[model samples]
Target: MTADTNTDLDTAQLPPPAEKSARALARARKRRSVARFWREYRTHRSGLWGLAGLILIALIAICAPLLVGADSQSVTDAPGGALEAPSGEFPLGTDQFGRSVLALLVWGARVSLTVGLLAAFLCVAIGTVVGIVAGHFRGWYSTVLMRVTDWFLVMPTLVLAIALATVMSRSIWTVILAIGVTTWPTTARLVRAQTLAVESRPYIERARALGGGHRHIMLRHVLPNVMPLVLAQTTLVISGAILTEATLAFLGLGDPTITSWGGMLQDAREAGAVSAGDWWYLAPPGLAIALVALAFTLCGRAIEAVLNPKLGVAR
Candidate 1:
């Protein structure tokens, strides 16, 4: 090849080297971001452990039924199966009807997780809309919306939930709906505050001056800024909803057909498992609920620290 051609080839090869360097730098930055998140996460040791415990419980819940090869509610009328202690045959023992407590705990995890996640999503959707409208549009609109929020805020959630569950029918979906509806008020209040703050920012004014539509500014600008708060609140709300569902189920407001942790607890209580000294019957479900709630609470706190660096405990 000619010297000129060789020189051009060399230049082309140099650009590839530069491109590789840029790519490497980008990857390094991504790694740093991940490391920073974990570092922040580790700052809150309790929260991290909580998240780990929750994840463990969820995994167990998801895998339990598959491992056991028995339906959560299956009744085995084997002699001496009822209220058996933890043994090789039955890890967490058997219920009054000879159902494996371990199996029920696992299946119940699925139900509780599903309810928590679904209810949290519902709350975020309804709350975001209400918050955006109330915060973005002041005067009569804001006043009316705020008043409605107040009405919900004043109602006792558990009491209202019982009434709703009684009226609507004792099902998982009903529990989800009741918990979701009642839970949105707190998120709405939080989102509204964030929306107001975002609306007052200089960029929002710039967007307005640039002839951006209200919808565009709100969705692109305000919503993005407030998303962190929404996410944190979502985690907290999910934990609360899960607990509430369990409480309702414990009170016999849950679907009889479902094998939920709460329902299991209710059954145990009704059968006098505690009084009869059947620790296996009550322990698994109760521990599952507590561990799941603890996990959510920790995750929420971790996310809060990540979103707000000032509050982050230093590693």
Candidate 2:
């Protein structure tokens, strides 16, 4: 029994296996990285505020199912009179259809947030790929790609998006596609500049000398270095995408079946709320849109500051 106890103690005291030790070290490094990120992020007051606002908005969007019911959106089953003023029963007042405006606003957040995130992601994905390829491969091929990007860049993004939206069937996906394709040139330009800077470093030459193929060099070396810039750009793109969605929806190009901020504005216009002086009907959605855009912009600036220390010092 003594020998068994000694053996067990010895086993317990032995160092961990190579794989387990490696995993533990990796986890420790990750924790340190996350801690360092938060510490740096805290120094940016604007970023903190923006993060708070975004969290609040995201939480509200997530909790829509719990906060309100489907009945609030039903025109036929509306509990309030048409264009009623704000009250305890109808907080933000009723719309033209007698549906609760507050409910519509909350529900609208879902669409705006969804479209903004998805469209921005698509835009960044395309831009990152294009930028990496363009930066890594120079010569006539890169020149042609850059010329195509410049063509898209010089054209007014809104006009191009509107043209695309007009051609496609009206739906959130169409809105996303239009915004994604139109807005990517800016990101591509930014990322391409960064990629060029990264690739110019001596490490890239060493990587090439070590038999690293194009795929290996890009994915392993170039991509990770440019990720911070990509992350910062994504926030700005989200704000633009949201605004574009609002524009498209307000112009009656949105899916007629859904409740969105721009759709609410369109409905208000059709209902003559502006002329009727029903400010409650018009204000909520407009304010919400502005706040969301501002929040994202603030967050983007803060992220840029955090990622690039020079910006942080300037602030």
Task: Using lDDT, give the best candidate's number.
Answer: 2
Taking all chains together, the TM-score of candidate 2 against the true structure is 0.92
| Candidate 1, 68-181: lDDT as tens digits | 555556664433366888888788888887777877777888899999899889988899999998999989999999999989889998888888899997778999998888
Per-prediction TM-score to the true structure, in the order listed: 0.85, 0.92
Tens-digit lDDT track for model 2 on 46-114? 778878988998998888888888666787898888999999999899998888999999999999999
- On the 0 to 100 scale, the lDDT of residue 11 in model 1 is 85
Which 10 consecutive positions of candidate 2 have the poorest summed lDDT?
306-315
